[model samples]
Target: LHGCSAVTYKLSKDNTTCLIVETTATASVSYTNSNRQKLVATWPLGEAAAISGQCESETKGQASLNLTFADYWVHMSFASSGGKASLAGIELFVTVQNGSRFLSPNSTGGLLLTASPKLPLSADTEHFACASELRLPFGQPGGSALVLSATKIQAFGVRNGSLSAKFATCALDARSSVPSDSTTAPSNTTAAPSDTTTAPSDTTAAPSNTTAAPSDTTAAPSDTTAAPSDSTTASTDTAAPTNGTSTAAPPTSAVPTTASPEPPLLNVTVFNSARVPCLRLQLRASLSILYRLKSGGNATVKVALPADTKASGDCGNSSQTVQLSFMQGWRSDLIFVKKASGYALQHLAADYRLSPALFPNAAEPNANRSAFGNGTYFSVASGTAYYSCRSAETLRLDNFVTMETRDLRAQAFRTDNSSAEFAGSMEQCLDDTPIDNVVPIVVGAALAGLVIIVLIAYLIGRRRHSAGSGYQSV
Candidate 1:
């Protein structure tokens, strides 16, 4: 065993549990150079020292161990159930101190590994082994790879307030030599047919009876002569033929009418003032709006935009626009603006007509909605590639209505630029609203008012006492 570590926890006053892990792991990063050449660098876990570690409980009553290294960190979580302790989650973080080594001058480092493979501790042998390699995606092929091999894991249970270190060796080293049952099953079935010799004798008697029946049927010419007249009579029956044709026609027509082609995806790319590509986005456009019905109830309706949306504006310009015109007299427009350091989404406006069936009791179903923002700026020179919003994010157009969007992807930088690769943590764009700070502002105002009242009362009482003393002396 190599690169081993152990962690012990005191569950109670007298009971304790321990976990031991032994494995060899390495991290390698690959990137492109300025001259368009690919290179890789590797660092082993054994070279780094474990500086600090702590054990904590998770939300689901599980134990987790967090270890910090000089250049990296490891988090391992475990779940105890059914008289066993199993690994629930594992994550590794690698810090790239010198970003220039990977052609990323603006990168601040990134996460290297994230996975959750439930592996239970062996009950009899007291060891678990892993036989696979983990890979991380870096927006390019062959980004980074992690190989964990010859791993041995053991967990000790609490027994009468003490710990036991007894464990057995894992048999993973000799697993390749053992033959599997699937490969041997076919050979055994094929060899068993050689022992059955009575199969040919039973087949010889069956052929003799079949040959005599065909010779006797050849002599019956009377039945063959009458077969054409019977078929002619059946063909003359128009009622049966008409019903069969009518029933089959509807099904063929219905199948083709229900199948509509999926809408094409829209791609929008933006450039900087220097004519350098900075941002790219692709999505199947859709609009969601909040409206009120005649019954005083509010609901949200989603309308898919047309695929043939007209796009206008030049790269590196101040703003770009995409206009979607529907056949039902509806229209939508999306606008993106160029900023000093980066780019941002400026506005989304739409005018839509709702179906009469959806709002039967409503007086008017025609509505218009829009959301505007100051726009969050993201830079490509900072080693950030992709920005994703996978869940529905609400953007309040006003106090009474909002808009939502989902499954949006935005990428930055040119194809050959390695400095724009994804690293560190993910970037998000949130609506910066003043309503989120109302609680803190109200509390501060209340405290300030109380301080002013106390000061004014103290000064008034001191002034009255000084005036009365001067009069009594006179």
Candidate 2:
């Protein structure tokens, strides 16, 4: 094991390993296996670690794994290549009987078997795991977790996005053996992120060669330009950059839409919405009610004003934008914001003084009451709100806010063969591509022609006609 230390188990940069004896001086080390499996030699091998060679006389059917020195413990890990590889004459294999497995040593933790294999769990998720905070380290490829903390149904780091972690909990160690070269960006976890992320109208048109397949992705607005005439108005214009993938974007300015006849008492706050670790933009402002767009815009939002009142705006992305209209007398949480496309928004529900997000009725289809509990495997449900508004309370809506609907996904459990499905998570715009109503647009356009013909004919006929003037006037 000492010679193997320099290259293997060093864990400096490359984490490669093979099944090795804990000590180099240890007698011929051998083990039985049913398949060709990759073995890993780990640093800080747990307590006593030793392995006996199957070829050795006294240790024919026995193998031990202990550290190189006395009082040192090392971890043992080996993948089975088909042949049964036994540890201390016992088979060390992974199998799922009732959705889980057994913990080794059988000390403080125990294994959990599904309640009844005859009636297996559904795929769309019908319940929550009964465990909590179960620590699971990464195992080798295709290896599953040994049921630890059977009472609390927690799978190490993976989250089940739904309210319950039943079908949502994932197998242990899903990361690839070779990590990606790309730098990992840590997700935002601030308690209250601000709402300053809207950008002004896109002035730049699509760059040349945006049509063909290209590396830089972005497109331009098909028809329209930045109206230098209207300095107060901001449009959410999509310009061609290259294709649909340019990293450089216009500066964040308020994208104004046609204003409605609403007062300024409304709040436009973004809710943090979900608890899963996601790559979402976080907002700090606590505006009021939020709505989702059913169609149109490429994350381009246009909030129009009624009287051209000079209302201040702010953006909450990468940097904080303070409100020019910040009034200390009024609570800052009273701004209305709608869910627009292209961007994401996040805020705490309490910031807006909103209602407690009502959890789905556990009695309903495929619901689990145990999901919101405090143990492992627990989670907030599909639409459950960590905070809720008081009954008979109303939150005023102020203006449009930015948000992305791409990440929302959902699935239903089939009562039949049992398979988990991928249903997108859009409370609105499930399939709202506007083109869904092609029949209406065509019908409306056809009816619109009669009015145009009548107006043109009336104006032409009313004009004075020159009778016989061409023949005599010359």
Candidate 3:
């Protein structure tokens, strides 16, 4: 009952059978060398020291147990639904310090793991384990991998008077071998069958050509008898043959000239507080998602939003909601609120449908799921500007899934204007200065004021003491 306070449930009648609910967990991490062929070192979480652990239960049949290590944190979510209890999702947040053991020295960003199993789990199982491969946003091939294993697991909540004893373990290994050229073999096998089928068709056509040759020989003697009359008509037909050859040349050139030009990447209109058109945004970007493979590997899934993806929302209002509806059940909503500084994105919610064809080995459920994440301040502004087109930038939603975009050329202008024109550059969306940076300057100013107050008191006391000593004989 350590973490089951929020939920209300009755215990089972059997008292002798103790249901183990919770236990201590351990975490380990391994990193690969420069070659990415094998692991260079393996280290325990928190350097083999004790870590803090806690559990939280929710009323909606959801519970989470979190383990906070020194450099990284592990959070596991469990859900009891439809008379079944299973692990819903897992998230790992690793901090890459200057000399962090969990990551490489040159690694600029930390590792993040957010994944779920393909199927649900039942409480009757003795041992349960799941593994997923995580590719670093900045890493070589054969990236990192994480495995979660649990033993003696029973129910998520208290069944009777006793809690279940569940022991969980997390192991992260880097630079596992990845299969790169496995798909080419099947393509070659398919091509071989097509070539064999065409060979039989060519042989059948050869017999028809031989039969036509005998008919041509029978007609040759008839043509010699008519040669005197044919010569008289050949002088007039010479001009007709030249006209036929010139007409055939025009159709061949006309076929290729009808191709249309390429369309823009993204162009949409946004609204204002009054639900009137305020901003027209246009951008070109390449987007992709990092998904876990069923074979315990990681792969990239590219998504191309059409040029006419529908967008609807208000810009500078507290209840502003901008929605972008893409193809294939993919949608994104950006909620904004008005502040003293300006309008800023408060939350971002995205819904994506997984296709089994593209991700045949994906561990996630092939259904439409929504993930929400808090947006950074100063990430939205008015007017038009060219955002820097650099490397891919990743946006992680609450599900821990990352959406990456590269070669961004985003801009927004008033809809009343005829052309999209603005000289300002927009480099502040993801690169804005955070409010945390002001804390140090504020603390320094407070310390400086305290020192000035103490110095004034000391000087006033010294002056009073000297004046009293000079008149002190009284």
Task: Give all candidates' CA lDDT scores.
Answer: 0.38, 0.20, 0.37
lDDT of 2: 0.20
Query: For residues 1-474, could you state the per-residue lDDT of candidate 2 as single tens digits?
Result: 323321121110011121222112211111112242322212222223222111111122222221222211122222111222212211111111112121121111011111100111112111212111122222221122111221111111112321222222112111224212112212321111111111111111111100110011111111112222111212333431111122123323334344322222222211111211112111112222222112222222222111212122222121111111222111121111112222212110111111112111111222111000001111113321111111122222111222111222211110122121222242333242245678888888888887888988887775534443454455
Native-referenced Cα lDDT, model 3: 0.37
Enumerate clash totals for all models, in the order shown: 1, 95, 8
Candidate 3 on 1-474: residue-level lDDT in tens? 112122212112112222233332333334443344334333332222221111212124554444444444554555666645555555454433335453333222234434443123443222121122222111222233232222223445453444322212112211124222223233322111111111111112111000000000000000011111101000111111110112111111111112122223454555443334444344432233444444444444445444545665433322344456666666665544444433444444555665665444555658444444444623435433333434446655443234444444433323354344323545544443246858899999999999999999999999999988867665
Model 1 per-residue lDDT at 397? 29
Please report the TM-score between candidate 3 and the true structure.
Answer: 0.33
Index of the highest-TM-score prediction: 3
User: What TM-score would each prediction reach against the true structure?
Assistant: 0.31, 0.16, 0.33
Off by over 4 Å in 3: 1-264, 272-276, 377-392, 406-474
Best by lDDT: 1
- What's the C-alpha lDDT at position 237 in model 2? 37
Q: Candidate 1 residues 1-474, lDDT tens each?
A: 134432232322101234455556665655444464656656666633332111222123344444445445555556656545555655454443445334432222232344454544444223343332223222232545444554445444434443333332222322335322223233432211111111111112111100000000000001111111101000111111110112111111111012122334555544433434444565554444333445443344344444444432222233433434554545544444444544455444444455553323332454322222222333322334455565555443211223445555555333333344232345554432125778899999999999999999999999899888856653
